[model samples]
Target: MQACGLDFGTSNTAAALPDGTVLPIAPDTAEPRLFRSVLFFPEDERTTYAGAPAITRYLEDNAGRFIQSVKSFLHSRSFRATQVHGRTWTIEELVAVLLRRVREAAGAQTGAPPEAVILGRPAVFSPEPEADALAEQRLRKAAELAGFTHIQFLIEPIAAALAYEAQLSREELVLVADFGAGTTDLTLMRLGPSRRGRPDRKADVVGSTGVRIGGDRFDAELMRHKLLPRFGAGTTYRVRGLSDKRLPVPQHVMAKLLSWHEMSFIREKSTQELLQLMLESSDKPETAEALYDLVMENLGYRLFRTIEATKVQLSREEEATLDFEEARISLHERITRAEFESFCQPLLTELEQCTQGLLERCAGAGEIDAVFLTGGSSQIPAVRKLYVDRFGEARVRTADAFTSVAEGLGRACVSLVSPDLINS
Candidate 1:
């Protein structure tokens, strides 16, 4: 009768038990215990599979079997994927596989099956009004299919704040900046003492803002601009591809890019599609597999890691160097922190614009109580500095920067079902 909380994100999916420990579900499932979010199918036609083994099989036999970031697909009316035999599958089916994996993981984690579950939903789904309802219905159905008798949708930002509020005092306005794999959401909340005392908590939303960007998009940017250009896919080889000739390079690059999938770069359609297009072209015998391999290594995969590393190194160090020794591309000159800031400036600006819009909405209403910072991207000094600059260090705080929401949802699920076990 344990409750469950799932942070079904675009890049990574995580689940937590009532005891408040969170673990990642392995996508291509390696060891039974290690957690990953990716799910792979043996073939496009085969029912999509889940776990580390599935991922490995897909990488070797059918690289296209992956159905990544289901959370990003929420709200879409249809999800179309090709089976190994070229059969088409619906979005619901894809979701079903993902949900099923969640259930399986949960069942294995705890002896008792989950009676009720809490799932996190994005702030903005489809731009069309009708699409929003479709997204919600799809999610509900997927949850039911996954075996939860009861399911609840919680806003990610709010959930993150609630998780942090557990140990925090309920006296002030707080800001919850949730930078996940796909989107960045800023929620302003005020926590009040629980009326019921079963360790209950109340939260009021002061202002909420969302940006259609996050850590994943940044990886794509790096790959597209910095890494790919070197090998000349869109540039030198307009009809580029992956070939045996390009093996070492593409393999290395793809490995690096795949390594950073946690960044959620695949959500950006233009970039994702472009990368997909490149992959598709490589499928053709006409394109030199070597070229494809080279591009894949030089630009397709390796680029994002370099960019990610640059971003991270720039946070504390004044400069960082990225060298693709295999591909023979190197940014030997010091990449100054200033340069890194400039590179990320646009993303920061977009986030700022979103924040400004939220502020305008709350201008006359009330001030944001506290600024809660969480997520891998939130750890960036550039991002951190921005928040601190706006709301001083005292008002700006980062609690559980990585796993707050998932853990909070776990606790919330337990509380919703069995209030008496509050402290447990």
Candidate 2:
């Protein structure tokens, strides 16, 4: 049996075969072939759903725990486990659930389950070597639990390069930028028809670099600038210790509130108590009340969804309205493209710096023959401009933003076993 290719992304996921066939792991999402990296477990806890079904189920029911961005915590030593429906679920077990579902979905279509797979990963799981190794180890364990006997690792940006190489007839030095939800990874490599099927092409890889920042960080920035103020993140209140002094919410609390997974912790009595304190002491108690109500209603998931929708809309339109109405609170805000870009400027700079780091390993920035952009975040105007500024508009290209890595991983899987092992 041919090895399968798995792209377990932070925001989306996909599975494919060496033959370039992308498995329809998720049939109900906006994009059927690419599944959302989310899970929903009802109060019973025995039954669970993933991808679009998970989101839909969570919306229809409220007593369950819905989790998103599971991939982000893999590198963090602090995020060892989380309470799901009152049961402690480890990071490995949670990831295993997603892996098993992807494999089973592929198995149903491919006659039998595959035992081997090529797993695509980011260039930097974390800057800390120990943390990076631990993240990979956890992923390997999860794959094992998912029933894969043989697993191989491939860098995500390089995988995108392989997918882009299929379109070229001649050799070219290509720079691939994978702007994923949790990380931005880039690779400078030589690829084309002439280089295809070369078993030992390690020499073709010129340089690679990556950074931890990605699309999700930009979303958080937008929330911090445009929406958090409405929820008392920027409002001032009196604390018992600081008798006459007024202070805004602690930076740490505000940080947690911006992240979907971390926001769930707000339901704890300690955090709720803090919010109540703010509500009682703040001059603008409405904002503090909004914050308290948001957490109690388990509405962080919905808020993130609203933020994501506004983000996607901003990619196409000059401005988008963020309208969120739930129990006891209604919010309607209009954010212009300039404001969004301004909010995301820091992250966009970090992304550009990541690309520059990769290019420096080559002779110069102009040494790259072409720039191939992939991932949903690449479509952002500010992100694309940063690349264009360095490589020029004529040198930039794009592939299927979400599936390029999976497609290329499929190609890599095929090459791993083909009879032609040596390049002429």
Candidate 3:
């Protein structure tokens, strides 16, 4: 029998089998890759869209009817949505759809229902313990709804550590940094031989801080601040180098720029309507829904692509440039190592402060033997540099960077079957 491990992250879902292999199961539908952790429903009815197709449709419709980043909603005190037909759906129901999809994907891929599964949980939230407990309960229920009989919720950073420990028999105190699209989690753990294979001897959760910002947020910031003014959001301007640069930026473009953030919370509806109208008049007959498609497919989508490209390039080179082929917009950004540090300085500083606070609370820094880094965003040069700078380079390591946690969870699941191996 094959055991399954599920890394249910805010942005993507990946599964690992007992044979030590990991695969990301794409969401069901036309766009067969990546789960946005979002769901949409028509306001007039209770129908809901989960995973990839729903994301694409929500982007195209932009009717304010979509529920995005549902994991984030898990942190909310209580969430109730009033649909178009005066119907309301709780956050738990929205999460049910997302988990149900994951269950279907995992079951379909392996041809076996997962015997026992490991899931990721956040370490901290604004409302303190209440938010933490709520997130935990919601996920457990979501897992149950997804058809999993047994569920184990592990701190995300610790899971990453277990993933790292399986690869090494050595005992060390390590810090694990798990950066995802939604938040950044740091854990200082002592990995050693115990009855539990690579068990966490004394783990200290330093901090899990979220800026309500990520690659998506940065892209929207850039588009709103830099691209809109000149792109004719009801007004037009000639391109810097081309005389034919006069073109309208459709409303869909603006909607895509918004992505999953909530900017209209305090703004009046009329103001939002005016903003929407200006965005519409700028380009063509682009609808809000259509603009979401553009945001996911083009604008907000493209901005993050550029950010990711720059992040990857910076890991290898000193500078990077962004080129928007369809829009004919290109910028050659010469980023020095120092300049790159400055770009992410605030976020990195916040992370460091968080780490320091956690360390202060959990004995001392010397107690931590090693620091591990995982997750897609953990690849950011600034993030790695901050950890290396704090803890010596020799003490910082990455197991499988991207797949460590999910892999560890798989191993942990196997240990459950043979209690003796957990202590081995």
Candidate 4:
């Protein structure tokens, strides 16, 4: 029976074949391997767009509703159904649409639809047990709706370890760090040529842990500290009837503006009325006007793209500049490495604590021989330093940022088909 591995990530998705070939399912005409986890629902067209084309259509014509980071909503019980293009869709149904596209692409690559699949999931979907269970249930339903008859779940970090394990010739204890868009997962496992063929390999897993923080959080931090301030994040407005009294603009509204999934809510009638009142009474009317214009023009995604680009640039350079010139909202700001690091200090500290906690949980286990990092957010210099400082530079390793998990999932599927071949 032929099988495939699917890595359905918060920011991107990919599928891989058992023969070590990864299928390119990105809807972009260029056929990039990593498909953007985004959807665009046009007002005038009945068809929906996904991946890069979705982003392009959203930018070219802002009239449509653009949805991103759909994976994050899987755990929210409050998120039931949303209306799009005069049609209502359940969360699972929306996810199924994206999964179906990936399934079709992978099927085309293999000449026949896969009979089984290994799906990569986070260590914990949510801190709450009920929510986590519900999220997994939703994921399974989505996969089934996408036409996958057989499925198995593997922790993402474990999948990364398996991908790295395939290349190991000697016995080693490895720590896999998968820093994805929605979460950072860690897994410590023992791998070697000697243990490859073992039918029961669960004993090799030493520990696994994850924190609900990743690249999206970093982007939010950058927006909150650097960009949102320019759009009146902290500005104050005078009260309508009170004398010598003023109140700060609602921080919740600013938060919604920075959130990728919540930005569209700012365009609601009630929110717009509040924004208009704030603009009329704000001491810094220009900032309020800019914020108002941003919502009215549906420029949240475009602004976020600029912020995300700056974050990526900072990962490679010591300094970066954010220059957004759209209509009446012109802003220019330069941020140095030290400043960026400071902005993300709290999150960096949380990452360190999470890693340390995982190590403590496996204290009696054997020493880790190497640290493997995967996922796009792992490219950040500060994130790299965290592992290098812990295990030394020589023991740290990295693979292709986006495809490792999918490839690892593929390897896991292969193991199920010919256990002796994968183990041997």
Better of 2 and 4 by lDDT: 4
- Which regions of candidate 2 deviate over 4 angstroms? 240-246, 364-366, 417-424
Between the candidate structures 2 and 4, which one is better when assessed by TM-score?
4
**TM-scores across all candidates?**
0.74, 0.95, 0.71, 0.95
Candidate 1 regions with alpha-carbon error over 4 angstroms: 23-34, 43-64, 195-203, 233-291, 294-317, 323-337, 365-367, 414-424
Tens digits of per-residue lDDT for model 1, 1-424 = 5568877767556677766677545534443323345676553454556655555565466444455556666665654443534666566566666766877777766765565778877666655768867877888887887777778877778778777767764556667888877789877777645521233343356766677778776655555444443443332212344443232223333333433433233334554444544444443322234334433332333344456677667667887776544333444435677766676788888888888788787787566666789876887777788888887887787766667777767767655655543324
The true-versus-predicted C-alpha distance at residue 243 of model 3, in Å, is: 34
Q: Write the per-residue lDDT of candidate 4 for residues 1-424, one digit (tens) a residue.
A: 5578889999899888765567877644565688787888888887788778888888888798888888888899999779987689998888888888888777776676665778899997898989988888999988898888787888999888888888999999999999999999999999888876455567889999988988999998898888887889778987767866888888789889767568888788988887888788888888988898888888888888888899999998999999898966887889887788899999999999999999999998877899999999999899999999989999999999888999888877766555433312
Q: Could you tell me how far off, in angstroms, the CA of residue 20 lies in candidate 3 after the best superposition?
A: 4.1
* TM-score of model number 1: 0.74
RMSD of 2: 2.7
Clashing residue pairs in candidate 4, if any?
Answer: 196-423, 197-423
Identify the leading candidate in terms of lDDT. Answer: 4
Model 1 C-alpha lDDT versus the unseen true structure: 0.62
Q: What TM-score would candidate 4 get against the native?
A: 0.95
Better of 2 and 3 by lDDT: 2
Off by over 4 Å in 3: 1-3, 18-20, 27-67, 82-88, 198-259, 263-269, 276-317, 323-340, 364-367, 416-424
Please give the ranking of all candidate structures by lDDT, highest first, separated by commas.
Answer: 4, 2, 1, 3
Candidate 2 lDDT over residue span 1-424, tens digit each: 5478899999999988876778888865568778888888988657888888888888987678888888888899998888876789888889888988888888887877777888998889999999999899999999999898888888999888988997898889998999989998989999989888676667888888889887888889888999888887767888877789888788887888787778888688888778888878987888888888888888888888899899989999999999999875678999999999999888877777777666666765346789999998998888989989887999999978999999888778867644332111
